[model samples]
Target: MSNVLLLFDKMGQRDIVTWNTMITQLVKTGDVDLAYKMFVEMPERNVRSWTAMISGFVQCGKPKEAISLFTKMEETCLKPNEVTVVAILAACADSGFLDLGSKIHESSDNNGFTRNTHICNTLIDMYIKCGCLEAALDVFEGMKEQTVVTYSAMIQGLAIHGQGEKSLKLFFEMIQTGMKPNGITFIGLLNACSHMGLTNEGLGFFTTMTNDYEIVPAIEHYGCMVDLFSRAGLLHEAHDFIKEMPIKPNAAIWGALLGGCKVHKNIEMAEVAMRHLQELDPFNDGYYVVLANIYSEAKRWEDAARVRKLMKNRGLNKTRAWSSIAVKGMVHEFVAGDDSHSLSMEIFEKWNELLVQMRLKGYVPNTSVILLDVDEMEKEKFLSRHSEKLALAFGLINTRPGETIRIFKNLRVCEDCHASFKLISEIVGREIVVRDRNRFHCFKNGTCSCSDYW
Candidate 1:
C-alpha cells in the first residue's frame, strides 16, 4: 500500500483512474478518513469515486455519513448506478431512515432499476430492517426471479420480527421452487424455530441439514441450536448440547446459553456460561452486565458488586443504552436519562400524562429489572427514563395520531419498559413497533406480537 501510494505521488500527473485507485485502496484498508481526504483533494470525482466513499462509510458502520455523502453526490448531478443505490439503501436501513429509503425506492422505479435482482434484494432487506414487513413482502411477491440470497434475507427478516410460522412457510415455498438451501438458509430456519419455541422442530431441522442436505454444521448452526434449547427453558439440554459439539465453542455459542440463563433466571447456569465467556471475551462489557443483572435479580448483592468491581478493574464500562426514532426524514436519538433534546420538557410532560392513564389501565412498573440496589421509589423513577421510553415519548409528540411509532434500541428492552409499551400502545390507539438487540416487539390493542414470550 505504501509503495503504491509513493509511486502515485511521484507521478507527473494523475487522472481520475489514478486518484480512484488510491481512494479504493484506502477504503479497502479501512482508512475511510484518509480516503475522504483524498476524495476531496481529487481534481474531479465521477460516480465510481462517490460510490467508493459511500460504500466505505457503510462498511465502517457510519450510515449517517454515508447518507449525507449520497445526498451531496445527488447535488452534483451525477446519477447513481445500481451499486450506489445498494450502498445507500444499506445506510438508510441501518439508520431506520424509512422515509428516505422509500424515496430511493421510488427513484429506482423511475430509473428502471427495480428489475435488477440485487436492488430488489436490497429493497427487501431495507424494508425489513426498517420495520416495514408489509413493504418487504410486496417486494418479495413482485420479484419475477428469486435467488437464494433473496429467500434467505426474507426468511431471516421474518424470524427477527417474531414471525416464525411465516418464515417456516416461506422456507417450504423456497424448497418448492427447487432452490437449494445453503448454510445461511438453514440458519434462518433454525432461528425461526428458536424464536417460536419449537424445540422439536428445531432439532428435526438440524438433523435434516446435517444428514439430508449434507451441509456441515457451522458454529452458527450450533449456536442456534443452543439458543433453541435455551429459549425453550431447557438449560441443561443446551449445556449438554454445547459439551457434545464437534467444534470448540466460541463466545457467541456461550453467549447464547447465557442469554437463556438470563431469561430463565438460572443463576447456576449463567455462572457456568460466564466462566467460559470470561476467558473467551474478557473485554466485552455486555457479558459482565448480564451476569450482574442475574445476581441482582436473585438478591445476590455481593456477587453483583463483585462483577461490577471486576469490570471497573478491567477498564470496562457498561454500554449505555440508546434508542432512535425517525420522524419527518430526520432521526431523533435519546439515551437513558437524556435531557439534551430541545423538546425534552414537552416529551417528559407527555409521558407523565400517558403515565396517569397507563396507571389507571393497571400499568405497574416491574422494578425487578432495575439492577441497582436502590429504593423502590428510586427504581421506579429510573425505570421511567429508560432510553426506549424516552424515544417512545418523543415519537408520540412528533408523529401523527394514527401513525405507527417505531423505535430501534441498542440493547434489549427491559421488563418494565415492555409492559409499559403494551399499555401505551392501547392508550394512544396506535401501533408501536420496537426493534431491540434480540427481536421486534409490536404492541397494539394492549397486546404484543411476541405474546409476552420474548
Candidate 2:
C-alpha cells in the first residue's frame, strides 16, 4: 500500500491513465477505501477512473454503491465506453437490478458500444442473472462476432438455467467457429452435464477438455467434475475423482461431495468429506451445518448432536439464511421469520393463504429437511418461514398474473422449499425462477428444471 502511494508521489505530473492504473491496483489489492480516496483526489477523471471505482465497489460486495457511482457518472461529460459499460452491467447483475441493467444495455447498444464483444457478453450475463433467459439468448444470437468469453457466458447461463442440451449444442458451435474452449468453457460444459445428471457425458467432456484442447484442469474444473459425479449418485467415483485430481482437492471438491452425500443419504461418505472439510476450511461454519443436517436426515440423532456440539466448541455459529427479491426496481430482503418489511403483515397473510392452497393441492411439507426433531405441525410452520418462501409469497402477491417470479437467495434452497416452489408455481400459474447459491431452478407446472434431483 505504501509502495503504491510512494510511486504515485514520485511522478512529476500524473496523467489520467497513471491515476487510473494506481487506483485500479489499489482496488485489486483489497484497498478499496484507499482507492476511493485516490479517486476523489484525482485532478482529472476519465471514464476509466469512474469504471475502476465502480468495478472496485462491485468486487468488494457493494453492488448498490457501484450502481450509485454509475448513476453519478451519467451526469458527467465523459460517456461510458465498453469497459465502463461492462463494469456497470456487473453491478446491475449482482444487485438484481433488471430495470437498470436494461437501461445500461440500451445505452451501450447506442454509440456503437454493443459492437464490442465484451459489452455484448456482459449484456448476456446481466440478462441471465436477472432471470431473463430469453433476453440472454437474444443477446447471444444477435452478436455479430463472438469471442470465447461470449460463448462461455452463454454456455454458463444456459447451464444455470438447466438448458444443458442447448449449452452443449452451443459449445460445439463455438468449437466449429475455431474458438478453442478454454477452462471456463469446459467448466460450463461440465456444469451443464452435472445439472442434468449426465455423468458419462461430463466425463467425456472432461477428457476432451484435457486431451483435445490441452487445457490443464484448474481447481474449478475439478470441482465441476466432482459435482458432476456427485450429483449423479456416483459417490464412489466422485471420491475417487477427488483422490486422483492432479492438484490437491480444495474445500469445494469436498463440499460438493458433502452435498451429494446429503442428496443420497450417504452418512459414511459424508463423514469422510467432513473430515477433509474441517481440516481444509476450519473457519467455514457452513460445512458443520451440512454435516449435522446429513446426520439428522439419516436419523442419527447422536451424531447430529455431536456435530453441533463440535461447532459450538469451535466457536462457530450457523448464519441465518438470507434472500431477496427485486420487484419493479426495488429490492425486498428477508431473513427467517423477520417481519420487518413495510408489507410484512400482507406478506405473512398471503403466505398463510398460499400455504392453505398448497395443502389443498396435495402439497405436504417435506419435514425431513428440518434437521430438528420437532412436531410435524411445528416443523411445517417453521419451514413456512424460510427466506425463500417469504420471497415467494412477496412475489406471488406483488407480481401480475402469468409473470415470472425471480428470487435470489444466498443459501442453497432446501429440499422442502424446492418442493414447495414446484407446487407454488403450479398453484399460482406462474413460472418461478429461483437463483440459489449453486444454480437456478426454473419451476413451472409443478416441475423444476433440476427435476427434483438437487
Candidate 3:
C-alpha cells in the first residue's frame, strides 16, 4: 500500500488509463473511500476514472454517493462514455432512484451512448430492477441490435416481474435468433417457469439445458425445479427430484421444498425436508420457524413446543423482523414497535389511526403466527406492532394523499401483515407494494395481486 502511494507521489503526466488502473486496484481491494479521494485529487480525470469510481461506489453499497459523483462529473464538462453510463445507471437502479434513472437514460441518448449495446443492456437491467417492466421492454424494443446479454437481461427482468409468459416468449425468440443460451439464460427461463407454476415446461427446459444445450444444471437451477414441483403440489415428485439431483441438495433446495410442504400442509414431506435442512443448516432459525409453523397448522402443539424448546436449548432465537420504506428520498427502517426514531410519537399516532381504520374495515388480526405463550390480546398487540405495519404507517404519514407506498420486508409477509396491508391499501385509498423475500405483493382495494397464495 505504501509502495503504491509512493508511486502516486512520483507520478508525472499520467493519462486517464493510468489513473483508472490505480482506481480499479484500490476499488478491487475494498478501499472505496481512498479511491474516491484519489479521484478528487486527480489533475486530469477522464471518463474511465469517473466510471471506475462510480462502479466502486456501487460495489461498496454507496449508490447515492455514486450518483452525487456522477452529477459532479456531468457538471465538470466531461462526457460520460457507455461504461460510465452503465455504471451510474446501475447505481440509480440499486438506489431506487427511478427519476434519476430516467434522467440517466435521457442523458445517455443526448451524449450518444444510448446506441451502445452495453449501455442499452445495462439500461434494461436497471429498469427491470426498478420494477419498471414497461420501461424495460421499451428500451429492449428500441435497441437497434440485441445480443445474448440483452436477451438474458430482459428475460431475467420479465421473470422477476412475474411476467413469466413474456419471459418464455423472449427465451424462444433468443433461440430462434440462433443465439446460444448460457447458464444464466437457463436459470432465468427455469425461474420464470417456476414462478408461473409451469411444471412440465420447467421440466422440459431442465432436460433440454442438459441434453440439447449441454448446460449442466447448477444448484440454483435445481432449486428452481424443486420450487416448481413443490409449489405445484407434487410433493412426492419434488422429493424424488431432489434425490435424483447430480449435485447434493443444499439448504436452499431443501428450504424450497420445505416452503412448498408448508403451503401444501404435507407434514410427512415437510419432516423429510426438515431432516435435510437440519443437516445442512442446523442453526438457521428459518428451519425451526417453518417446522414450528407446520406443527402449529397440524394442531400438534406438543411437537411445536418441542421444537421451540430445541431452539431455546441451542441458544437460537428468531431474528427480529424489519421493514423499510423509501420516503422523501430517505429510507426509514422500522422494527416491531420501535420507538427510537425521532418522530416516534407521530408514527405511533398514525399507526393507531391505521389500526382503527383497518378494524372498521373488518380487518382481523391473525394471531396464529405468534407462537409465544401469550393471550389473545397480547397476540393482537404483537400483530399490530409488526415491522411491516410500522413501515407502512411511516410511509402513509410522510407521503401525500393517494400516492403509492412501497415497502420491503426482510422475511415473508406474515398472514396478519398481508391482511393488514390489504386493509391499509383500501382504507387509505393508496396502492401498497410490498416486496417480501420470495415475491411481490401489490395490494389495492383490499385485494392482493397474488390472491393470498403467497
How does each model score on lDDT? 0.93, 0.89, 0.84
Model 3 TM-score? 0.84
TM-score, candidate number 1 = 0.99
Best by lDDT: 1
lDDT, model 1, position 454:
77
Model 2 segments more than 4 A misplaced: 3-22, 40-46, 75-78
lDDT of 1 by residue, 165-203 (tens): 999999999999888999999999998899899999999
lDDT of 1 at 181: 92
Off by over 4 Å in 1: none
lDDT of 2 by residue, 390-418 (tens): 99888888889998898999999998899
Candidate 1 collision pairs = none
For each candidate, what TM-score against the reference?
0.99, 0.94, 0.84
What's each prediction's clash count? 0, 0, 0
Q: Which 10 consecutive positions of candidate 3 have the poorest summed lDDT?
A: 445-454
Judged by TM-score relative to the true structure, which candidate is superior, 2 or 3?
A: 2
Angstrom error at residue 219, model 3: 2.0
